[model samples]
Target: MAKSKDISVVIPLYNEEESITELCKWISRVMESHGFHYEIVIVDDGSTDNSWEIINNISSENGSVKAVKFKRNYGKSAALNTAFRCSEGDVVITMDADLQDSPDEIPELFKMIKEDGYELVSGWKKKRYDPLSKTIPSKFFNYITRKITGIKLHDFNCGLKAYTSELVKSIEVYGEMHRYIPAIAKWNGFNRIGERVVQHSARKYGQTKFGLERYIYGFLDLLSITFVSKFKKRPMHFFGTMGTLSFIFGFIVATYLIGEKVYINLFLNERARGVVEQPLFFLALTALIIGVQLFLAGFLAEMISINSNKKGDYLIEKKIGL
Candidate 1:
């Protein structure tokens, strides 16, 4: 690792051909002005548009630009993971190809990540130009992410973010969780996180690729991150806790049912009845079953973790052909 490093800009494109040429030129100007060594990695995520031709032209003109064209669209996660695997700079920055994220904000983000010693710095669009439909759901999503991950980032879904080489290389972004990079970094012991109020422009060249269903998936991914981060190596801590709480609640419910049965049998002189046919019994049975299953899941996770440790499964083998 170098003391002062250049920035690697990674942009993931999906049918975003119109923005690629302009974005590459803009990034080149920034790189030249800042006097930092940089590479523009444009990952074409199986774009049905002429995205590859545009990226090739840009990468050819400027020696700084490199691209990986996916045979088919594998989503943003695959594109980012592939780009990160091939990036060569000390500071890795990621932005969307839709031109909503301003390239002019790159230098400041790079400065914060490199000079300020922040492991991760994410952009916050204070005044988004999105419609109420997108903005409303985004706010709720960010709130849920903060609550679950305990990372105080306002815009977890912001595409504009910069990460130190160590942090970027160490972490793996899969599923729809690239939006939660800050939280992921926090969970990986990279606690020095920062945020910058970046300039967010309305879509200039293409339509938004965002949808409401992505928020639903993002929320679910946060839950997965929460459990995996807090208890990846100790799954029993999480599952066991849930199991114990469920079992306790079930026990209380069963005890109340027993008391009710005793009173009914003695005071009312009703027929003696077994509890299994009762609804409370079914609830108790369900709880007990779920509890035991969760406990076993934790135990299984523990075994898998131990086996993984022995196997030495790693995410990044090398960076930029290192």
Candidate 2:
């Protein structure tokens, strides 16, 4: 096993050849000035450029610099997730390789995690240099995320963040869920999430990899995480409730129509429209069928949830003398 360090700065990069060297040097300077026993873990996400070569060169020169190069480009989430598993640090800090996230924020973030008892500390870029086209949607995205996840962080997608080693290991980040790490931490019971206003520099090299479509995907992922967190253990709660309501509504409407027809035919002695002929009869039938289908779906989900193998599904747990 590799020796653990006081801090591990994990950077995930793709096609960032121009900025990788400078970023590593800046991080080393910060760690040295702060007297931190630190290791820099840089993951090259299958960059076709010279980023992986630069990483290899840096790691060769600096023993504290550990690097990984993927066979092909996985998204940022995969890069970060893999690095989290490989990191051996008491406190883990993640920053973008684009140099937009400043290395100066490391010390304070480290303090927040170590001294302030924060399980995770996310950076907030209070002032940004990006164009309105990007910044506007980002603001809206953060606002909606705040409302849904209730994490209270102004910037959830900020790559410059710090975490306790335990917090990072306890959570699993996948899909486009990188933006919701704070929320994921909270769901995993790491509720002591803090935020610091950090400097966001203009990109010194390469263009932004993400586009406007990310916001749409982000919103969908937010909803997905919320649903999974709330209902993963008891999916029947959601589906069953909706199904029951729909079934009751349909039953009530059908009964009322039948009763009205019977009254008109027997008591009033007048011809009444056939129940099958009324448009509401078909509406009620459709609702009933949909309700049954949803209820059955919930039943299957519950069965799968009960029978699925749950052992070894969780992250590492501390034991005294196991």
Candidate 3:
């Protein structure tokens, strides 16, 4: 194991061969000028381009640079999670490899965790250089995320952030949950989260690896995190509550239909439509079945949770040790 350093820069990149070398050099310059002992841990998320080759060359020339290349593309969250495991630094700083995330913010981010008593410090790209197509959706989603997660961060998906080793190691970032790191940290009891307005640069090299589909996945992941954070240990609370309400509503509807049928048959000459002939009866039956299934689903999920591994798994094709 490498000795614990003052800072660990974990950059997760995919097909960013064009920018890897320059980004590393920039980080080295910033950290060296600040007189901080730092290690740059670059994680290549199975880039098909020459990214791994560039990373290897950079690592060979610079002892401070270490890298892990994935066996396949596992997404940014998986890359970060794997790097966090391998990082041996007091303050773990994560940034993008595309050079858009400035390395100059490292000093303050380190101070926020090491000196200011914050568990996690997220970067806010106050003035993004993205096109309207990206910025508009990002702003709307950030608004919704702030309201839902209560983290008060302007940019939850900003790749530049800092964390105490304890905070990063305590939380798991997987399944596109990298966008909700602050929220995840808060849920795990690291509530002293701070934000810094960092410099965001325009893409000077490759195109963005992400599409609008990421935002769609991000919204779903936020809902998943909200549910898991609250009911991870006791899923019965959520599923059972919803199931019980649905079952009650359906039972009430069924009882009403049956009672009306009996009343009409007893008091009027006209025959009441059979309860089975009514659409309400079928709808009520479907609701009852759905409620039962949901309750069963909760039970099944609880069982899997008990036996499933909470820590994520990933395949590393190669490692360049420091």
Best by lDDT: 3
- Candidate 3 lDDT over 155-234, as tens digits, reads 99999999999988888888889999898899999989999999999999978888898889989999999989989988
Clashing pairs in 1: none
Best by TM-score: 3
Each prediction's RMSD over C-alphas, in Å, is: 4.3, 4.7, 2.0
Q: Give the per-residue Cα lDDT of candidate 1 at 179.
A: 80
> Count of backbone clashes for each model?
0, 0, 0
lDDT ranking, high to low: 3, 2, 1
Q: Give lDDT tens digits, candidate 2, residues 1-322.
A: 7556899999988899999999999999999998899988887777889887787788777778887777777788887887888888899999999999999999999999999999999999999999999999999999999999988999999999999999889877777888999988998899999999999999988899999999999999999999988887898998898888889889999999999999999999999999999999989988888889889888899898889854222132111111
Clash count (model 1, backbone only): 0
Regions of candidate 3 where Cα sits further than 4 Å from its true position: 1-3, 263-271
TM-score of each: 0.84, 0.92, 0.93
lDDT of each: 0.82, 0.88, 0.90
| TM-score for candidate 1, residues paired by index | 0.84
